[model samples]
Target: MLFVTIDRKSSVSLTQQIYDQIRKSILNRDLEEGERLASSRGLSAAIGVSRNVVLEAYERLIAEGYLEVRSKSGTFVAKGSFLPAKGKTSEYEKVMPNVADRKPIIDFRGSHPAMDQFPRKKWGQLTRDICYEAPDHIFGYAEPGGIRELRVTLAKYLQRVRSVHCHPEQIMITTGATQALRLITEMLIKARTGISVEDPVTDEMRNIFFSAGAGIIPVPVDENGIIPECLPKEEGTGFVFVIPSHQFPMGGILSIQRRVQLIQYARELNNYIVEDDYDSEFTYEGAPVPSIQGLDPERVIYVGTFSKILSPALRMGFVVLPTHLIETFRRLKWFHDRHTSSIDQLVLSRFIEEGYLDRHIRKMRRIYRKRREVLETAVRASFKNAKIIGRAAGMHLVVDIPDIDFDDALAGEIEKQGVRIYPVEHFAMNKGRHTHQVVMGYGSLTPEQILQGVTQLKKFLSTRG
Candidate 1:
């Protein structure tokens, strides 16, 4: 009989145990291909397990391609056809120990909004109201340019908040800022043009631009954000993407002077600036900073998303375009998606006009500001040497690990200890610059979780020596 064992007392079921043993035997080459497994009755009697257990095991083995079941005949191991040949590799099934299977004790992963914090009841009522008050036009395919009311409301909202200058007609709705960026890149990144991107920028943008076949010029960023002085003075460059309000990963706000300088550079170079006003709604101190788009609406393509302010699954965002480029953008948008969902646009429009969105944001602002303070206090009490970056605004903060590189090995070690953090190196176009940093998202985390997670991190880092 082929070697196998079963434990009746163990939590693992008999079928699962049998399946695992048989699979291992085949993988280890002990039971060569074409070997026949014993009849279920005989195996059951020999192993002192139930006949059904043996039969179920055989069924699973057959289902998984290890054993083949014949009509009213005994089960037999299949040929070595599916197995990898000697000295060959399969990247598809490259088996690593399942790290994700482990439950995290402290979760600090970024960009996730607190679903519990959102006013679900209020939103539901608003959605219901929109449906109840819908006119005949609401039931049909909306204007390819999005709902008129939403565009008008958003234009006024952005103008008041970000100081962006644009009419409702100039704004185009999108699925999200990511989609907006994708559409923009496809529409402009070709024709042998190079886009200047900030080094240690968002990883998704790097991939998006690269896939569009655009050459990238990595501009270095400092504590004050992207150094405009370091940008290449070239004519071939057509796009400059920036996170001006609160820089991603590193939380440095672009000063008014730098903002003006950036717009002046874009104007002088005759290139367009893709201002991703991502996560500017959660400022802790002082008045909100005016968006760079406010400087020169004609030169800046301002992108905003509801993902941060509201929820990500909503997939709603808009771009305020220049008057001259509105036609080009409209044409591009017409061919690409045409417009966002009519229902979502109308409902969101009502949410804005009814002042629910502002009310919600105001509440969250105070809540997040306190959470930020609590996080700071915990980190300070725990990891005294660690430096916090981008603390004034946004959902995440970068904790500088200092001197040591937070490589994959270190990340794995921390993960093993039941805490998760994103290494800053993952976001860098050029490595080694952000090696000493890790992003900690506290938007969804409570004060207790943040304290406990940071405390765990401090302990883990302290144990490194």
Candidate 2:
């Protein structure tokens, strides 16, 4: 007889507990490969959980290749099954992105948008009204791609604002950029593809590709954005992922000439270009550049998120697929959590349809532009050698420091002065090129706060002499 225990008091589900223990026994070699396990009914009777619960656990283990079902026979562990051997030493835990270091007086850490300027009142009303107006289907399992209403509205919106050309069928709403990238990575991996990414990208983005088992070729980016000439000449390179509209951290808009070259490069390589139009809404100096996707829609994958233009707390993002990849992308998206929040999608659809998004962007644009100006002015006043990088667009800019090592030690010193700043090297993959720079995000701070933060930074640098 099999002896199994259940903890009714535990927050962990009974199914999960059973799965974990059974998996542990296999990994510990306590349960031999091909050993027959108790039937779901027998296990339920022994442990006193519902038969269905035991069945669910067994199904999960079977799906994961831990167990197998034989016709007219009891369940048995899969033959030749082995879990990775446990390391003698415990593995290091991942560090949280923003480790709370006693709330600083001024925050210059990048990746924040102007939250105070969000039209909460209008948004709440839209949510309520849309819920009232949306059909019962909004609460049910959404259409695999998304609710048709949102997709249609976004199609029109992107075309009008970003010069993107896409049909409603080619657009898919995702939980966020993370999900979009995950699905895209899976698709590329299946195609036996290698991806070319901007060298100084966030570790979070890099990990996505690494997890998908895709080869990562880091291409160099100058002021003109990702240099087309530097892209991989090697075969089997499937795509180049770029934020050409507004390059992140070191915010350079890819030049028109470079955009043409990139499109031509993709055509020649027979590859795709993933355009992450992340922060194009807040460009202060010139009109926003049209998306590179417009130049060659057939070879480009355009992804956008409301997380930046709206509140980050809201996980709403969309991916515009090429016609060739739509079927595969849709099929994979359906299996990846079924659909995003239906209600949120419906509400966002109505919000865009009623022109609320345009109104909000216009309002926030003026506000963030001022913050950028305030930040740049302070930088000019404090450092004569401050080589301001990527100020033409985006909420944050990079200030390159020379003659001094601006590493963790200097960042710690700045943190001690009640200011938070992110070093550019923090985002670099191969490193060294961006070690002399730190990124300052102004979109989230007020004019007064920006001035004060810069003053503190300047004072700290003065003390270094």
TM-score of 2: 0.77
Alpha-carbon local distance difference test for all models: 0.83, 0.85
Backbone N/Cα/C clashes per model: 1, 0
Residue-by-residue lDDT tens digits, candidate 2, 152-179 = 9999999998999999999999989988
List ranges where model 2 is wrong by over 4 Å: 1-105
Ten residues in sequence with the least summed lDDT for candidate 1: 81-90
| Per-model TM-score versus the true fold | 0.78, 0.77
**Highest TM-score, which number?**
1
- Error (Å) of candidate 2 at residue 195 is 1.1
Report residue 295 deviation for candidate 2 (angstroms).
1.3
How do the residues 90-151 of candidate 1 rate in per-residue lDDT, one tens digit apiece?
56546654677758567786766776787788878888887888897888876666789999
